[model samples]
Target chain A: MYDALKNITFIIFDLDGVFYRENQSLEGTKEIIDYLNEENIEYCFFTNNSNYKIHRYKEKLLTCGIEVSEKNIFTTTKLIEHYLFENNLDNIYVLGSKQLQDTLYDKYTQNSINPNIVILGMENNITLKDISNTINLIDKDTQIIAANPDKLIPVKDGFELECGVLIDIIEEYTKKMVQVIGKPSPYGFDTILSKFDKQKSETLMIGDTFETDILGAKNANIYAGWINSGNKLPYNTLDFDFMSFKSLIELKEKIKEAKR
Target chain B: MYDALKNITFIIFDLDGVFYRENQSLEGTKEIIDYLNEENIEYCFFTNNSNYKIHRYKEKLLTCGIEVSEKNIFTTTKLIEHYLFENNLDNIYVLGSKQLQDTLYDKYTQNSINPNIVILGMENNITLKDISNTINLIDKDTQIIAANPDKLIPVKDGFELECGVLIDIIEEYTKKMVQVIGKPSPYGFDTILSKFDKQKSETLMIGDTFETDILGAKNANIYAGWINSGNKLPYNTLDFDFMSFKSLIELKEKIKEAKR
Candidate 1:
C-alpha cells in the first residue's frame, strides 16, 4: 500500500488548504518542504486561484517559513497563458481579477466587441451586469475558458462563490461550453509535469480538495495523496485508490517510512 | 376553426411585446382593445415584469392609447404579494428591483437572517455580491420563489436577461427549487382567472412569447393565441393546440369573423 509513495520523486502540491489557508500557514508546511529538500525530491505549488500573480504566492510562501523560487509555483494564470499560446488564441476579454486582466491583456489584445477567447477567473466584485456584458460580447464563435471548476471556495467566514459559478451562469445563458484550465482537466497537471520534465507515474499530487486534487491526479494519470484539511470526501469516490493522510505531518511520516 | 375565439368572453393579455414594446405602442394594440371594449368582453393585462408598480404599467398602457384600470394590471410584484398573503408567509427577502422591494417589504417583514422566503425578480443592476449575499441568507427551510421564468426579454438593442437567469444561478448553486410566480407556472393565470371570475374555457390568453404566453395558457387550460410580434416559436411545442395571429388586428378580425 505504501510502496507507491516510495517511487514518487516529483510532487505537485495544491496551495490554499494544503500549505497556507489565506495568510496563515497550515501545519506541516515547513516540515514537509524541509524533508522534500533534504531528499532532493522535486515539488511545486499549483493553485486553481487566478486572483493573484506568482510573486504574491512566493511572498505568501516566504511568510510560511518555506522559501521557494517563483518557478516552483504554478497558478492557473500561468497555465492559461500557456494554453492560449499553445492553442494560438488571442484577442481576449477577461472576466476576472485585475491581476488576471493585466497579465492576459498585456500579452493579448483586449477585444470587447468580438474576442477570440473569453477567459473567466475568480473576481470578488463581479456583478450580474458584468456577467451580462460578458454574455453580450460572446458570439457563437468566441471561445470560453475558466480558471477552475470549483463551485465554491471555503473562506474565513463561509464558502464564497468561485469561478465555477460564473462558468455556470455564462454557460447556461450563452449555451456554450467553458473549458476549465485548472485541476481535473489534465491541462494544468500535464503542464506542470512537462515543466518539471517528469513522468506521470513519478509524480504524486497532494491536496485537500478531492474533486480537484485527487480526481485531477487520476485524470492526469499521476499518483494522488489526499491531505485531510477539514474537507470531507464526496459521497461517491468513484473507487479511486489514493493515499490519505490526516495532516501533512502524517504525510511526511508516511513518505519517510516508505523510503526506509 | 375560428369558433374558439367566439367563446372567449374574458381575455388575458401579456403587456410587453403584445401591446407595446417599451414606450412605443405596437400595431393593433388600440385596435384589439377597442374591439374587446365594443364586444363587451372582459380583459386585463398580466406581465411577468416585477420591476414596475401597477401604476407604472397603467401609465405605459395609457401611453399606448389603451386605458385600463390599475386593478386589471397584474404585475409579478402584485401576484407575489397575493401569493405571500394566500400562503400565510412572512419575513421575506427580495432580490429584485426597487419597486419590488418596496412592494414586498411594505407588506412582509424584511428578514435578512432566517427569512421565511427569498423572492427573486429581474433587477438591471443586480451584482454577483447581491446574489452571493442572498444565497448566504437562505437556509434549508427558506422557500425560494422567482417572479418569472423568462430567460430573456427583448429590449430596444438586444435581449436582456430576465429572472430566469437568477433562478438558474441560485437553484444551481443552492440546489434549491425556485417556485415561479409568473407565466408558465399557472399561478398568475389561475389568480387572474379567479379574480375575473371566468372559466378557463371562456378565456383566451394573447401574447407574443410562446413559452410564457402560449405555454402558460396551455398550463392554465385556456385558449392560447400567439401573436407573431417577431418571436419564433420553440422547436418542440409538445403538440399543443393554439391559435396564431400575425398581429392584434388579425386577432381582432378573427374574433369578429367568429362572431359573424
Candidate 2:
C-alpha cells in the first residue's frame, strides 16, 4: 500500500487513546504497524503521557499488538531526561507514576536537597506528602519542569483527568509554573526532527485533533493530514489546508491514489 | 486622600490598551483583584472593546480585565441592540474585524442584498472594493454595518494601525468591512452604569497594560500606571492589590497606605 505512498519516509503515531487505549487495542492497529514494517515506512511511537518509562510504553504498545524498542519510542519524559542529562541535573524531586520515577533512576545521580530541578508526571501515588516534598524543593529555588501542560488525556468513557490540572493546583500553591516539554511545545518536535532526515513535506503528521495536531503542523509548516475522525471544528478557524481520513487503511489507499 | 475619594460614587473605564496589551496583559492582575473589592465595589467600566453589540459575554473574564458590569460601562457590539428601534439585517457581508463585525453586526436585518453589515474598525484595511458594493447596498443589500476592529490608534513609536486600515482599504475594493458604530459599542459601561451607586471594591478588575479604559471604577486592574507622569513601577513586586490606579492620584493616599 505504501508503494503509492511515494517519497513519504516517516510516519508518527500517537499513543494512549489514539492507537491503543490503555491495555486494549482499537481494532486494526496491528495491520497498520505490520504494513509499515513490511514497507520500510519508518515509524515512531509518540506519546504525551509521561507516566511511564520508554520500555513500559514499548511493553504497552506490544500488548496492543505492535512492537518497538526503547529507542523507537519518544515520550516527553525522555525529552526532559535528555535536557537534564546534557545539563547535568542532580537530586531531582519527582511528581509522577512509579514508571516515571524509575526512568530517572535509570539516568541520574542520587537525590539530595538543593539539587537541580523538579520533574512532574501523573503521580498515581499523589499524596499530600508528595506535594510537600515537591513544594519544599521548589521553595528552595529549584527549577520546576513537567512532561507537558496538556490538561486532559482520553479515556474510554471520555477524557480522564491528566497532568495539567495537577500542574495548575501545584503552581497556585507554589507560585511557580512548570516548564513544559510536550506537544505544542518546541521540545517534543525537536526530539522527532532530530531522529529523522526525511523532508517535512514528505512526512505526514496524522493525528485526531486540530488544536494539537493541526495547529502544531501549521506552526512547524509541515504537510498536515488531519485525522478528523473526532468530528470536530476549531473554536478559531485554521489556516492550512488538510486532508481528512477515516482510517489508516483508507489513508494508505488515498496515498496510493495521490502518488498516481 | 481616600476620604475625598470616598465621595466619588461611580466610575467607568475602557479595556483594551488600558488593562492589557492588544492581546496579552500583566501577571499578578487577577491575584490582586480577587484580594480587594470583592464587595461594596459597584459599577466598573470596559468601554473600548467588543466591537460586538453587547450580550453573551456577561461572564468571560479569562481574556480581559473585568467580567462584571453591575452596570459595567463596556459595550458589546455583537449582542443584538435592544430597542423599539431598527432590525432589518440580512445579506450583510463582514469583510474583516471579526472581533467586532461578526461579533456585533452578525445579527442585523436588511431590506435587500445591499450589504447590511459593513463591519469596520482598527485593521490594515487590506481589501475594500472586493465586497463594499454588496455591503454598502450599492447594487443590492440594504443597510451597512462595520465591526469595531480599529482604525489606527496611537501607541509607543508611531500609529498602531487597526480596523480603520481595513475599512479605508476595503472602501477602495469591497468598500469597507461595514461600518455600524465604532467605539462605545452598545453596552457602554460608562453610559449604562454611570447612573448607579458605584464603588471600588464592588467592581474591581485587573489588566496587564492600557489601551482602552473600558470603564470608570473604584478599582481597575493593569500592568502600567502613570501619575500625570511617565510609566513607573513603584516597587519590585506589586504596590497595591486589586486596585489598578493609572495614576497614584487616581488611587487614594489611604489606599496606598492600606496597600503598604
Report DockQ per prediction, comma-separated: 0.57, 0.02
Please give the C-alpha DockQ score of model 1: 0.57
Chain A TM-scores, candidates in order: 0.96, 0.81
Distance from true location, Cα of A72 in model 2, Å: 1.5
| Chain B TM-score list for all models | 0.96, 0.49
TM-score of each: 0.96, 0.47
Error of 2 at B185 (Å): 31
TM-score between model 2 and native: 0.47
On DockQ, the leading prediction is: 1
Q: Residue B259 of model 2: what lDDT?
A: 42
Best by TM-score: 1
